[model samples]
Target: MSILRLPARQQVRVLLLSSLVMLAACGEKPQQAGGEMKVPVSVVTVEPTPTEVFVELPGRVEAIKEAEIRARVNGIVQEINFEQGSDVKSGQLLFTIDPAPYIAQRDQAAAQLKNAEADIRSARLFADRYAKLIKANAVSRQEYDNAVAQAGQAEAAVAAAKAALQSANINLGYTRVESPIDGRIGRSMVTEGALVSAASATQMATVQQLDRVYVDIPRSVNQLAQLRRAMAEGVLTRSAEGDALAYVLLEDGAEYEHPGKLLFSGVSVDPGTGQVSLRAEFENPDQILLPGMYVRVRLQQGMDEKALLVPQQAIQRTSDGLNSVYVVREGKVQPVAVSVGPQIKGSFLVYKGLNPGDVVVVEGFQKIRPGAAVQPIPWKQAGAKPGSQPGGPAGAQPEPEATPKG
Candidate 1:
């Protein structure tokens, strides 16, 4: 068995046979690698369900009603009846003007009326005496006529004085200013001891009703038209009652607790921005929403009964603006073009090019290629593999090793 003892021809034949065996083993290893390698991917089964579509837009808060308090009479402001920046009711006294001048004028008119009444009594007695004298043929007819004329003049003077007294009384009542509406009042504009005049009435304060507030939001006219077209084509269904439900999102991303209803949408569009105004009413009993505060409104536009939804991460838009998704069919990965609609809750509403129960690749997309055989696994967060019980198969097993040829 020693090498030196073997013949030359025998050694050469042995070397050739060993080299052939090594080459066959090397060729078989590559065949196993090319045929059995399978890409592992996570997939989701597509399903149809009812989906709600919402439109978010910017808006501002407004008070339901606003009133400006003004002075109505000419006088000096003697007292402020209500506290500044406090809630006030209709007919509540807010300010008091000095009433001394009006009172004095009223008293003078009353005294003049009393004097006129005295003169009327004296003239009536004289007229009666003249009438008796004329009947006795001792007085002239002209004298009796003069006495009757005097009595009529005194009656006219008494009527004038009474009219003056009425005017004074009205002016006296105007000294007390009252609230015009029930609302929260702003700071006093004119303080005590300030002169106010009816010729140019001074604004005393402002009162605004805040129990119920209005939110004015602007929406693009073009977008609204598109929505209407979609509804007419049966792609979307509006609420039966016509009005949409609305919610508010604060700047900090907190949602308002109370919901609001759409009141009306403007028929005319703004020429500059091409947007239509929308108004919504919300119950703001707590006064949390202030006028002019910036907010975001989530308005429910419509609903779709048979909507196909896919996670946002699964969608890919090519450079040519074609949207597509990777789908797993019969253990093979393939890309399918899809028509996507508006996004709802972090998912896109697939309008076309997909069917129910289709497996969509949600993860491991980078490791897969078109027409490649893949091991579809249930998608989980991150790359953590699903745990398997002891002695149980984790996933698809590797292809059985090829038997060596003789």
Candidate 2:
């Protein structure tokens, strides 16, 4: 602690302190060139857009008109004219019962009718002769009365014979079995030789009209209240189109070509599932779509007048389920949270946290940190177009975790 020392060690300490002070004064400045973080990124323009929103529901294909074809008379099946599972017109003959028994009954009735006519002719002659005899007083009154009684009995016999013939005709008409409606018939339940009755215990076969088919979908009852509230606020509207358009996706990942129409909505909610039934109708000319086929329907819900769109690559969900995006401005990265809407065209409808003029960072995000300096490149020319495709739909899958080329 000596201030002024004549010793050699004291002078060496003073020279060392002076050298340290001079070096500190000449040192590098704060915020030097190497301190800045650099990141290469792709930028995309955020535009306010008006887009369509769709609600997806699971549904199964169904038939609009279905029925069980049955026999109306008791007889053995003599012939079957219609093919199994083939389309048939109304009143088309499907099956024919044996008409032999009915024919015999009809013939017997006709024979009795002819016999009655012959008896009438003889009775008429007798009655006419009696009348003449009575007028001339040539025959006894008792004989004339007997002839009149016989003639009246013959007339009653003729009427009874006519009634029998009419009943026979009706039975003969029942032998022909016809289709009640135009539809596609299922396989024949009874073979050519099987006997059927008007009152059979089991159904013969089923027929369904498939050209105009129905589809039933189930949705939670909670959606009803949500829809009503939306309508009151003018956020939604009851579809004016009688046939609200619906698109169907098949099991094989292909979409059904023609759109369907919403037909009816069930009033009663299901107690078990707390779901309501929604019915729709479609035209199936090719008969390719069948009942019970699992499908996804895209129901057009409503449209948004002003919306924001963002590509899929630009948004990422954090571990805590918060949606975050990295935006680029003046070669700097900023993380922002956004609210997303329905997914469409491999992109999302951004409802909040973005504006029309902001540039969003799409690529090189994993390597950069918040507030890091970045080399921002326009998305279109930086690389391949983002959100322009699905993830390898038909072809072989691209290698995962591979480094993308610059």
The clash numbers for all candidates, in the given order, read: 0, 0
TM-score of each: 0.68, 0.67
Cα shift from native, residue 136, model 2 (Å): 22
Give residue 86's error in model 2 in angstroms: 2.6
Stretches of model 1 off by over 4 angstroms after superposition: 1-33, 102-171, 195-200, 240-242, 315-324, 329-342, 352-355, 365-374, 380-406
RMSD per model, one decimal: 12.0, 8.6
* Candidate 2 lDDT trough over 10 residues, lowest sum: 391-400
Tens digits of per-residue lDDT, candidate 1, 4-80, equal 57799988888889899999987884434447578998777787676666667788999999888887789999999
Predicted structure with the largest lDDT when compared to the true one: 1
Question: Judged by lDDT against the true structure, how good is candidate 2?
Answer: 0.74
Question: Against the correct fold, how does model 1 do in TM-score?
Answer: 0.68
Would you list the clashing residue pairs of candidate 2?
none
Whose TM-score is greatest here?
1
